[model samples]
Target: MLALDFINIGNGDCILIREMEGTRQKFALMVDFGHDCLVRDDHPGELDPRSQRIYAGDFLRELGVTHLDVALATHFHRDHIGGLGRVLDAVTIDRFYTTYLPPENAPELDPFHPDNNLPKAARSALLCLQIFTEALQSHPGRIKQFELVPGTETISLQLTPDLKMDILCGEPALYRRQKEIYDAAFNGERNGYELVRWAKSMNVCSLRQRLYYHGKEIVLGGDAYAHVWETVNLTPCDILKVPHHASFDSTS
Candidate 1:
C-alpha cells in the first residue's frame, strides 16, 4: 500500500489521500476541509475549500470512497469545518472526532444560527450546525461526541505500524449568567483588536502521525498555549498540523 498523499488544500491546510481500497483497492482519509467563504486559495480563486470536497468526492468516485473511516474536526470554528458538509453529503461516515463543548443554551443564542461568532448570513453555516445538532441529539447507543478532556491518548490505526499520537491540551468553556465573572489572568485580557487572537487561543492541541513512512512522524498541535506546550512532554515530528491555524503567538 502506497503512503497517503497530503494534498495541499492551501491556507495552512491539506487533505490526506490514499488509494481507494473500498474492497479491491484501499481507503481514503482526510483532515479539516479548511475555509468556507470563497477566498483566493493557493491554487486559484476558483478553487476554494469546496474544492477539497470535490477533490475528495472525485477521488472517491473514481477510487471507490463509498465510506469514510475517520473525520477529525480540530475545533468548533468555521475554517476547520466549513467544507465538511459536502463530503458528508457524499460519503458515509464511520467515526467522527471533535472537541465537544456542550451547547451553552442562552436565551440570546439563536440555535438556528450555526456560527456563534459571525452574524447569520451563510447557508453552509446553518446547514452544518443543523447536521451537528442532529447527530448529537440522535446518537446511537454507542455513538459519542468526543470532547478534549485532560489526558493523552495514542490515536493508532489498525493498518499502521510505529506511529504515535495523543491529545495535548484542553479548551475550557465560559459561563455568562446572573453573575458576570471575567478571569483575565487565566483566559487573558483582550485589548480590543486582540479579540480574534484571544478567541484563537482557546482551542485544544491534537497530534497526528503517518507511521514509518516519509512524513511519518507528525504532530498536529492545535490552538495550545505556550505553557501547554512547555509543560507537556512532546518528542517532536517531521510535520505538525498547527493548532489555531499557525497564528503561533503565545505569551510566554
Candidate 2:
C-alpha cells in the first residue's frame, strides 16, 4: 500500500510518502518539512491559534519512523524548508535533495553579515539554506548523500518496484537567468535590491514531481507558478497538490 500524509503545518508543506507491506513500512520519503515557527515556542505570533500545527519530526517519531529513504526540499522558501533542522535532529536521512545550492563563498548567504541587505523573504530563504547546510554538516554520517535536482531535464526514478517518480522542472534557461542575477549581487556587481525584487516574483524554478503508484498518478507542485507549467507536458492526475498555495497567480 502507498500512503501519503499531508501534514498540517499551517501555511507550509510537509508531506510524508510511505510504501507499506502489510503493517510494516518498506520505504519512506518526505517532501518539504514546513517552517520552524510551527515547532518553536518563541514565535507564538507566527503560529495561528486556530490551526493545529505539528512538527514533522515529532509526528514521524510517533509513527515509529527511524529513517527516511529520501527528503526533498522543492525550493528555498522558508515555508518549504524551515523545519528541516528539526527533522534532521529526529530521524536519519539517506539522500537529501534541493533545487538550488547556495554558494559557500557568498557573503550575502550569511544572514547576519554586515554587508547583507537582502529583503526579509530572501533573507529568510538564505537563513533556511544556511541552517539546513549546517545541519547536514553536523551529521555527516547520517545523511549519506546530498544533491541538487538537475533543472535542465526531466529525470525519472523508481522508488520501489511498484512506485515511480518523475521530476519535472522549469527550463534551465530560466534558472540560469536568475542565477546570473544572484551571482551579480553576490559579487557586488548589482545591488541587493535587484536580487530581492527577482526573488519575490520567481517561482518558476521550483520542482514539480509526479508519483505513479497502483495505476494512479499524483502530482505534487511545489511553489511552481503558471509559467513553469507551460513548459511541462501535463496530464490527468488522480490528485494534484495545487501550486503556490492555490493563489490567483498559480493557475492560468
Candidate 3:
C-alpha cells in the first residue's frame, strides 16, 4: 500500500509519502518544507525562541518517523528550503535530493550589484539557502552526501517492489543556459539587468518527479514553469500537484 499526505505548512509545499511492503512496516519520504512568507517581515512572530525551534520539529516527531529514507528539496527558493534546517535537525535523513546548480556551475554573484537590486523576497530566500548550505558544508562528510536528482531518471524504492519514482523534468539544459547568460553578463557581454530576473527564475529549475504505484500516477511539479514543461518528455498522469502553486506562469 502507498499513501500521500499533503501537509499544511502555511504557504509552503510539503508532502509526505509512505510506502508499505506489508502491514508491519513502511518507509517515509518528505518533499519540501518551507514558506516564502514565513521568513519575511510579515511573519506572525507569535512563536517564541523555544516554540520556533519546535514548530515543524514537533510535527515530524508526532508522525512517529525516526528516520527519513529520502528528503527532496526541488529548488533553492525559501518557500521550498526554509524550514529544511529545522527538518534536518529533527530527523536522520539517509539521503537528501535536490537540483540547484551550485556556485561552480553558475556565474559569481554580486549581492549588491547596482543593476541587480534584489528585493526583500529574494534576499530572504538567499539567507535561507545560505543557512542550509553552510550546515551541510560544516560537516565535511556530508558535503558529498547530497545527491542531485537528475532529469529523466527513474528511482525505485527498496521498501516496496511495486513502487517507483520518475523524475520527469530537471533541466540541465536550463542550468547550462543560465550559466552561459550569467557568465556573459558578468563579463560585460550582455545586459546585467537580466541577471536579477534569472536569479529568481530558479523556480523553473525545479525537478518535477512522478510516483508510480501499480497503475496510479501522481506528478509532483515543484514550481516549474510552462517553458520547462514544454521541453520535457511527459505522458498523461492520474494526478498533478499543480506547478508553482497553480500560478499563471506555471499553468500557461
Top lDDT model: 2
lDDT of 2 at 187: 59
Writing each residue's lDDT as its tens digit, candidate 2 over 56-167 gives: 8888888889899988888766677777777887888888777655566545346656566556765654565566566555655777777777678887889899999988
Candidate 1 per-residue C-alpha lDDT over 179-206 given as tens digits, one digit per residue, 9 for 90 to 100: 1211221132222333333343334343
Estimate the TM-score of every prediction.
0.55, 0.85, 0.73
- In candidate 3, list every pair of residues with a backbone clash: none
lDDT of 2: 0.76
The candidate that wins on TM-score is: 2
RMSD of each: 8.0, 3.2, 5.2
- Backbone clash count, each prediction separately: 8, 0, 0
Off by over 4 Å in 2: 39-51, 102-108, 112-118, 177-190
Alpha-carbon deviation at 47 in model 2, angstroms: 4.7
Q: What is the lDDT of residue 129 in candidate 1?
A: 41
The residue ranges of model 1 lying beyond 4 angstroms of the native Cα positions read 8-14, 17-27, 40-64, 101-164, 171-200, 204-215, 225-227, 242-245, 248-252
